[model samples]
Target: MLIVKNIKNTIKYFIIILAISLSLSIQTLKAQEVAIKDIYFHTDISFEFSDTFGADRYNHFHEGTDIMGEQMAPLYAAVDGVVSYMVNPEGSWGYAITIKGSDDYTYHYLHINNDTPGTDDGNGGIKNAYAEGIERGVSVKRGQLIGYMGDSGNAESVGHHLHFEIRKPNNEPINPYNSLLAALNSEEYNPEIAKELSGTINDDKNIVSSSESLCESNTLIKMADYSTVYYCGADSKRYIFPNEKIFYSWYDDFSDVVILGVKEMEAIPLGGNVTYKPGSRMIKMQTSSKVYVVERGGTLRWVQSTSVAENMYGEKWNTYIDDLPDSLFFDYNIGEEIVST
Candidate 1:
């Protein structure tokens, strides 16, 4: 009887292990089904978003996928869908396109030159469609030639590339890279991608070859808080500047906290010549445009006010000190606040 009981116990353990293994295999297969639209060589051109964008702050999460391509690389429709709504709200997206997929998801294409030809009913094609929509005000369809690629709108500083976003039925953005994994023939390139830069200083110098080769040696610099400063030349090679004391910090991804000043220093006005305290913590960029008073005692808290030096994305900050002064300075100015607040 004891021998029989031992046999049954072993079988039960084997079944449990089998179940766990099967579950993991199913998840892996699901991951493999993601489709990849285009396979561009990954270069440290400074803006390839990863699947795990905010791992350090909020554990792990990503919003979109960026395809590396030339200025006007044609973006094909990943799947058939109807045009939903198109808007050039702030001209930040240059000319933008939005499509609703059969899967009840909406795909957004931002930073296009203008609508593609043959989109409208002929009176106004892509141009008229947007114009009419703006006049009459309505959402527009899939497969419509919304616009061509151009370095327009807010992404002007960055190189000309398409900013594609996938949203669920409820409009939550998902990582575009993962969405295309299953549909492509080539395996996803997980190796580090880089760009090369090399040029000589000369007046009207004749060039032989503009680009050399894309390799893995491209050094990446994450410039937030107070990281490192990199210099790029016409040669396209990036050389790191050492001995520069840059500062960066890690904070909660969803925290609306802004650093007012170095710990124990009086709040400085915007545009005023200022200096940091001995132990000041330089502030990182955030999403909102308001200057906030954050008092850090045993717990950290923030009070939003109007006292902002500049406005970004149409958000204005202009108020006065309402909270008690605390230690640490946040240097998140220069009009690049993260907009997840």
Candidate 2:
């Protein structure tokens, strides 16, 4: 009886220890998970990004979400991670940093700043690329400022932005779009500061006082005090660029964007919004789930099935789609449904 009692006591003690161990494990996991769940995509003002993961690039698929922002904008760590690799500083992954985040995941920040302060010289070097004390093997906290955005290396022609990616422990890339959008600090968007960062608000003080001095057709114009760009059409009306994607599809850089005074810019009658370059992208309305492919002259042909969408845009076709506001429905005409063909 005595032996049996002792054995039972041992068993009870073991059970208690096991329960305590499990509780501790759960608490640890919850702490790490919470830390990761609240990661902040650091930015002082509003920025823009699109989900282009798995989209076809020059050769390989686009593995990252490009967060478009002003040059020198601060970027933050996506999670509590140890800097696994830092300073790739080559052609493609310019001034890149890789972190071995908790939960066996990884985070990548590429196209980091390589430009001198207040200039696109692309030679800011290590001091400018990373935050103070950030280096390989450095332990970084979640939401800590890690680097600055830039358009270095192959991203030189695309404009200043940060190419952010998340990966599994196996190094397979995953889309960071959803997570980033959820965590982005979208407050304090000052247009005056944005215009100052753009350095284009006052480039063209040659205000138009008469019709002859008005912007010519095919010219891009914006108000001196605003950042909205419009395409001055041959019809003597100005069409809105709608968004960055539509604007980028039409031109490379904003070098030719003429700045006009408010009165002159308002003088031109507003035409409809410009559509995406035909076949370059797909779009869907915010009010509807149905996706449409843009055809010539702003015709939107609905894709009848997923297979047809894949056949038209490839395996990662969904990544190419952008959501448009319901108010712009009149800007496009609904064409025939895209069947298997």
Candidate 3:
């Protein structure tokens, strides 16, 4: 009886210790999660991100997140860190700046516009704190304007965007998406400024017009054939639907079908049209050359537009479709010239 009691007591003590250790570990991990104040500030109201971290680049992995913005848009320091390095290379990364934050994470800002006299690498560049007082070894405060967005180096052909990255102390890349999102949704984020810049309000959930509100609720619907699904918003004034081509593989021959995993529906006013500008997320395609027409309420149909094709693919956009195998071109009439609005 004594031996059994001792064994039971030992097991109970071991379990208690294990639980305490686990609790400490979880607390440590939560503490390690980066906070918004540890990075730069956003002066622009509208925030748009293109390529996400961990995306597949041509032959390598994309180590950073690309924030899409117009040329000369302001770029600020994410945290209070010392400028570790600044270089104007000719090819990849163009004019770049790196700061080692006090939090022991390194922040990278790449492809800044190269127009500033002293900072210009002759490709594209911007003047940052290095001109004022923040150079290598110089400390910087969070939200300090470091440079301007630009299309320098290899990005000149791709247009203007800031390729931002966060790295471990040892230089290993970590995903910056969560950190960026946190900053965008924090109290410091200004919705009015986002509206003024992007003409929209970006919340933690989704993008909506500043004048509009996110649907407080949702309802699911299935088509008569049960082949399609749609989400109805609580407003009763708008409905959200999936892109048909994406959901149904309507044009499998031309390109691979891309399903945007949009779980929540973006609320739209009833009977209003949703327009997509160049580089908008609404424009879904495997490549820039192959364009699809997306209609209101989530219906994607076939339409032809010479101007859109030319703008998207220059003058030789048709070559992309011509290269498709004949067997894959069965669905649409090849000669029909249906103009897209």
Give Cα-based local distance difference scores for all models.
0.36, 0.68, 0.50
Worst ten in a row by lDDT for model 2: 199-208
- Off-target runs (Cα >4 Å) in candidate 3 are 1-37, 88-92, 116-131, 188-341
- Per-residue lDDT of 151-233 in model 2, one digit per residue for the tens? 87788899988888777677766667667766653222221222222211111111111223356766888988788988776
As for model 1, its CA RMSD to the true structure in angstroms is 24.2
Among all candidates shown, the one with the greatest lDDT: 2
Kindly list the per-residue Cα lDDT of model 1 for residues 62-90, writing each as its tens digit.
34555544443334334456666665343
TM-score, candidate number 3: 0.42
Q: Which pairs of residues clash in candidate 2, taking residues 3 or more apart in a chain or in different chains?
A: none
Model 1 TM-score, all chains together: 0.31
lDDT tens per residue, model 3, 1-341: 99999999999999999889766754453344344434543424365874355554675567778888777676767877788988734345577788887768899888766653333445332232122344667777666556667777678678777888888888867767677876665432221222222221111112221223434323333333344444333233233223443322222242321222333232334422122211122232443344443221222233346665555445764543322223323322222122532
- As for TM-score, the candidate ahead, 2 or 3, is 2
In model 3, state the lDDT of residue 91. 42
Q: Rank candidates by lDDT, best first.
A: 2, 3, 1
Against the true structure, candidate 2 reaches a TM-score of 0.43
| Candidate 2 wrong stretches, greater than 4 Å | 1-38, 88-92, 185-341
